[model samples]
Target: MDFLYLLKERFLPLSLMAIIPIISVILLIAIWKKKDQVSKMMLTFVTVISLILLISSLVLMLFTLVIGYNS
Candidate 1:
């Protein structure tokens, strides 16, 4: 069940990274329609949040594996 354990460990961050939809069509539409700065700012914010989630989840996974927190 090592694969299952790894999945559990990595799921949250991977899920967070899955928010690319937020940056997808709507973002393109915003730029195409309004050409406003707000959508650009939102894109940056969402991207940062996604990165933070992935990084934090990776750190947690490393801790669990290296320090044996799941033991």
Candidate 2:
């Protein structure tokens, strides 16, 4: 019961953090394989957006951790 509670609380932030790296890897691989300039540019844009999301998620996780700790 306690473990389940802990997992439930931490799952969202942790999963977000975990999934970004996988997405980034896939994006990078796609970018590597793609030959067209337009497609590459689009993939690059998406990659940048994913990186921004990852950073924001990290910030959110940290904020949550700090808030949880202080409270």
Candidate 3:
């Protein structure tokens, strides 16, 4: 599928990067819901990890666009 190819082209990592925010949101809700598995420590960890991922993805996207990507 063409979608698979798109992911293969480095967007896979971007997708992963994007998912972190969603996960964070879920964790936030879980915290409010008093889920046993979701804790403040876990949220803090994921938040840091997501920040790193977001920055990396942004840098990569900028770099890719600068170099040019074939349609």
Highest-scoring model, lDDT:
2
Looking at model 2, residue 6 earns an lDDT score of: 54
Candidate 3, TM-score vs. the true structure? 0.44
What's the CA error at residue 22 for candidate 2, in Å?
4.2
Candidate 3 collision pairs = none
**Which one wins by TM-score: 2 or 3?**
2
Instruction: Tell me, by TM-score, which candidate is best.
Output: 2
- For the record, the alpha-carbon RMSD of candidate 1 to the native fold, in angstroms, is 6.3
Which residue pairs of candidate 1 clash? none
TM-scores of the models, in the given order? Answer: 0.45, 0.49, 0.44
Q: Candidate 2: give the clashing pairs.
A: none
lDDT of 1 at 2: 80
Clash count list over all predictions: 0, 0, 0
| lDDT of model 3, residue 69 | 55
RMSD, one per candidate, in order:
6.3, 5.0, 6.5
Q: What is the C-alpha local distance difference test score of each model?
A: 0.58, 0.66, 0.60
Report the CA-based lDDT of candidate 3 relative to the real structure: 0.60
45, model 1: CA deviation in Å? Answer: 0.5
lDDT string, candidate 3, 1-71, tens digits: 75556556757455655665566566555555664666778767766665666666567655654453566
